[model samples]
Target: MMESMISSRIDIIKPSGIRKFFDIVTQMEDVISLGVGEPDFATPWHVREEAIYALEKGRTNYTSNSGLLELRQEISRYLATSYQINYKPETEVLVTVGASEAIDLAMRALINPGDEVLIPEPSYVSYSPCVILAGGVPVAVPTTEKTDFRLTSADLASCITDKTKILILPYPNNPTGAIMDRENLIDIAQVLRQHNILIISDEIYSELTYDGEHVSIAAIEGMYDRTLVINGFSKSFAMTGWRLGYAAGPEVLIAAMTKIHQYAIMCCPTISQYAAVEALRNGMDSVKRMQEEYDRRRKLLVHGFNEIGLECFEPKGAFYVFPCIRSLNMTSEEFCDQLLKTERVAVVPGNAFGDSGEGYIRCSYAYSLANLQTALERIGRFVARVKQA
Candidate 1:
């Protein structure tokens, strides 16, 4: 009736900014949603077949708390071979229900009450709430479009305070599509070491980079011991619904995360773990192909935004584009609502991420080519009408 003596913190939590737009758009049956941050593709046939085969073979029961041994080993090998991220399957890896659970586990494992976790602004909405729910404080560090929305060493250095215990680094970031390159990562690592801050690097979109490559901060010397790497098949292999992901870090940190996960999560879905293993073993090709398609759409969106009078940075990774809508003289929310009301194209306002996101709107390019074309035209017309008004 009253959420069973719910904690005051829970009451203070706002619903996800990204999710709130869904209700508005869903009521309009004809609207095209470019709002959610997920791939539009289905899990590949081969991966799905593996899951079906597992269930058909009567493999429906629970697996180990960490995960099926084979899946953890496969993920260990995949990270090393693909991204040069070395992890020990036995002691350094823990599987959970998607990267979201991993984020929660990491916060619970590392944070003491009143500890501060630095999260970059305009990031996924979950970071701050999870920090607060774990009795930790969230210190938001703003990243601007001038830097391609990528968090830099200066930003990291400026945000570090004595109470800071963790930093959630969501790179190949959502909404902005910015990536931390080898150099930026190394510089940030230096600052982190200086402040003795632990890093929770969210690399779920590692496989989606259109830049040279996705480099894990954990791959740097000495950084591995201080970094918890969160990754999953959701973005890379189009397996969002399967709800499988894992974290790799030092044995001590990983063991703590495993303990929390064992009690709270038990294990990831068994069938999904089987499929994720297949993905790790032989799914690089699919990732490469999908990235190529995303690259094409990324270029198209950048060009379309510029032509339509919105200034946007070209995203080097991930599938979303953040376009500045201040020229319309309306807030991001006003712009998105007006566009949706008249043209039936749904997008998320930049402030959905953080206060720093006020004058922008995030449009995901995970849509089909035809849908993107139509959405862009509608947005263009909306811009023209706003100018005239």
Candidate 2:
């Protein structure tokens, strides 16, 4: 039997809900997809042109195991000025394929077999699997709509056991769109310090916060020494395809991650590093304009869902809304599949994110306004039809 030859670990994971929706949406015509995680905008013209110029000049080889010095310096400055996190670019940062790769690298570098990784539930799909692959167990702590989906320090404390080696802090979070304020972060930092645990802080959506400015755990006293801050151009600069991201932490940890990067990716795309420098230096204007658009869409979708009788939270960060649909008496998967087959509007089932996501569905507002309005109309009709029967 192939079971003897194939690794058992591979069977523990399956195709992702995000990937499943993507496959169906690609085959369907005229589908209004709000399930996408990437920004709808193109990379700014100047940023794109930088990559073009780099290619024309024949700078197409690997830069370094880490990344170009100029790009890393730009990232250091960007994080310092924007979030007040001080990172020495030369010793503390390692550029990776994307934030996705950075997450994988961080888990692989830090985790050991039988160690536990404390995670907040209803988060991005990658955290748990990456931990599993790293030979660590995932300990998911659920967050709720009552708490605005913010994972509190007490939540962190309650989840801790002696075997817990790391905590994955994903704020300005995915799916639910919740964000933690400074006071919340300080309290969590205290808990982390008390337990002597490390943190993998994924701030990929840092620039996309709407209610207030983004904050970093590393900015707090005693936090920098124990935190790995992950960021990239994909969310902020409309540069998802550029596939460039970086991790900043202690020199020892960054070195371990860089060794993995050297063997696995060798180097991030050279052109992307050039484009990211432009993005970091001149991309704020583009980010502001894009955030404005997302805000408008956010308001529209939240209002639209409520108008049609779906109770949902107004997300504080990122571009998604997690709407509770238990009133319809259908499971999240059933609702999503029926909606897709009937109205051709693709939104992901909440259960895809975690157990706390049941009875809900997640919709990204990263689509155009026209599509949002059309999706609303179709969803409204569908809801009416289902309720009538």
Candidate 3:
């Protein structure tokens, strides 16, 4: 009887595949987890100090429904300086609890019932479920290792239909760590130009790009007006617990999202908003330092996986690497489960992200070099045993 009270939409969505492994790890000892997609570093001292100072000063009142104007201004300046895209802080930005909230707001505000949202798989798991909850159809446009898991113009164009309302561009993608460079975006933009689709570009990992500077699709000539860029302090600034993110786009869309935000969220935490202001203003040097460390680990993990006979692609952004395990003749889940039970190393199964990720497993390098070295050794042993079997 209680089950009947739940919405069918809620029933249809699977629990997060990433969280499933972590739950099991919590019950076990000596688990070295590469399953989490969080930065292992502490939030920078200055940013944490700002939060502490805000608490000491008793500035705990709710900020504006749109968020603190000062923080929004910093976000505007940061985007302009970092990505060469500009958004008016006053009318074009709405602060939320995290990029997660910003994504939810965008889907709810833009998706009419039955409208389809295009998501490139394998992707961060939230995109499809969020679209479903907002009464939108989630359409998967599968990407492959052949393109370094980056979405192509052809695949994107083929997925569009008259009912298509939004395309979620999750670059420096979670699970995959694939990034779309300027040349790649130009090709994608050409296909989008002829469509009426809006873009929700989740750029949470923007600062973590290891190659050249990260490019924003919103910076493309015709994209700025239609693209809502979602970003936050979590991945780059290591402020996951602070729970602050924002959306920058046209005033009309921002206004619409803020309306939903006002009713649903009211405002982001006051202390977090204050800390985020400091993160944007003075914490970029800390981000650079963290990026340097992540790049080093990224190289180590890629090399280690390849040496162990897993075919790993070098990812230019983010701290995760998706190594193919097809040659082992087991499913992604089977490999992850057996590795965890045998070697006590925790990595996420790629199928947790989407169907296209079935033959891969995502390993985050956001761990100490010692832990990564040990995990690599354990994984190598597991691979050998599986091959011998």
Q: Could you list the CA RMSD of all candidates, in the order they appear?
A: 1.4, 1.5, 1.2
Candidate no. 1 TM-score: 0.97
Work out the TM-score per prediction: 0.97, 0.96, 0.98
Model 2 misplaced regions, further than 4 Å: 1-4, 14-23
Ranking, lDDT, top scorer first = 3, 2, 1
Q: Tell me how far the alpha carbon of residue 354 in candidate 3 is from the true structure, in angstroms, after superposition.
A: 0.5
Q: How well is each residue in 276-357 modelled by candidate 2, as lDDT tens digits? A: 9888999899999999999999999999999999997889899999989999999998899899999998998998999899
Task: Give the Å error, residue 277, model 3.
Answer: 0.8
Please give me the total number of clashing residue pairs in predicted model 3: 0
Query: By the lDDT metric, which is better: model 1 or model 3?
Result: 3
lDDT of each: 0.89, 0.91, 0.93
| Model 3 misplaced stretches (Cα beyond 4 Å) | 16-22
Q: Per-residue lDDT tens digits of candidate 1, residues 28-143?
A: 88887778788888888889999999999999999999999999999999989878988989999999899999999999888899999999988998889899899899999999
**Residue 287 deviation, candidate 2, in Å?**
1.0
As for candidate 1, its clashing pairs are none
Q: Which 10 consecutive residues of model 2 have the lowest summed lDDT?
A: 13-22
Query: Higher TM-score: candidate 1 or 3?
Result: 3
Report backbone clashes per prediction: 0, 0, 0
